[model samples]
Target: MSTRPILALISGANRGIGLAIATGLARQGAHVLVGCRDLSKGETACKALRAEGLQVRPVELDTTSTASVTRLAERIQQSYGYLDSLVNNAGIGVDDDPTLTTADRLQRTMSVNVLGPILLTDAMVPLLEASGRGRIVNVSSELASFGLRADPDWAFADFAMPIYQASKAALNSLTLSYARQLRDKGIKVNSICPGYTATEATNYAGNRTPDQAAVVAIRYALLNGDGPTGTFANDHGELPW
Candidate 1:
């Protein structure tokens, strides 16, 4: 086993679930890179965590921009040379406006939630490969489960946010693809739903807190090479695809 301390990069870690994930990893002795679009907020989050004596660094990364994403990878490469984990937690939701065109909604939602992560992962895969024990955690949602949504008898079946749901569903697919492609490289990739966590994304109207949801993502991030890959799970356990 590599004696090197775990190094992780978490996107959109200024607040909410991303911040929670960063804190959890830092608390467990990992060097966490907190990625945020706004440098000030990222530094603030890093400062708060550092006050707790955790190893945390603020990284300004706008996942939606290739330039920003590339810069972050280069920074990480120069600073650490390798990364043990990546938590792609940055995402956004759009109003389910009937007046909005599908193209508009998809472009906005998929850009941040889907394309951004894919691009970042492509750029960072090399650094992750450098780590003997690499992991990737994509913070997904139960709402992304098509099986549950398609089930008429399921509770919360009435809950429907097309654009948001579609984005997560696609993320889940991407998770599987990366997991399979990188399995030989010893990189484990998995998707996790933080549950109905109360965050800005949900307007703080969720049952679970950000800390609660952070547990599941952190668990997968710290997994060993023998751990499950290409899977979707949460606090409760494995979720249906």
Candidate 2:
């Protein structure tokens, strides 16, 4: 067995898809760091995983806060020294309301869904570089697809969450930029549309379970250096940009 223990960091992992991904990675023998804004929830999640004989630990992280991101970086540096994979899974949704929407709503949505990942990735680059087989997986959505957005025949047109859609689109662009910059550094960065997953965030409207989404994410996380970069995928195949 490869003794190079895979160190993975998953944000917003207290519950939902983030927690599911953490559990899946831990099951595969990866040392998982679960980042959550709530300490109690984080501890609970850690305990649940530990009970299953999985290696997991809770780390305090609020992606919207720069100070929190810096502190998380320092904590990881002190404990693990390096990270093999990073799953930028934290995100939020804005209620569909064109009349009530304000700049604050857009800002908050973008800050959490888009900017947060950028800051966290920037903070963890050194650790990823040190790993030599680094993988950065941004949990994007099908709503981010420009082709889908432009096509009236697309199913997503039936449900219009403009703020959330725009944020994911921005995240996809960020993934591309990062993948390009890190290409020479041996870090493979890619975006994934986990499909419509059933979670609290989605109010259980989705047909797929969180575990199903986690499988796709873990697959990307464990991919070799030769794997595709700057691409998007679901359970079936690659998606259109």
lDDT of 1 by residue, 66-94 (tens): 99999988988898899899999999888
Q: Say which candidate scores most in TM-score.
A: 1
Please, what are the lDDT tens digits per residue for candidate 2 over residues 62-149? 9989999999999889987889999999999865545555787798899999989999999999999988888999999988798777
* TM-score of each model, in listed order: 0.96, 0.95
Q: Candidates' lDDT values, in order?
A: 0.91, 0.90
* Alpha carbon deviation, residue 183, candidate 2 (Å): 1.0
For every candidate in turn, the CA RMSD to the true structure comes to 1.5, 1.7
Which pairs clash inside model 2?
A: none
Candidate 2 RMSD computed on C-alpha atoms after optimal superposition onto the true structure: 1.7
Cα error, residue 58 of model 2, in Å, equals 0.5
> In model 1, which runs have C-alpha deviations exceeding 4 angstroms?
97-102
Model 1, position 164: C-alpha lDDT score:
91
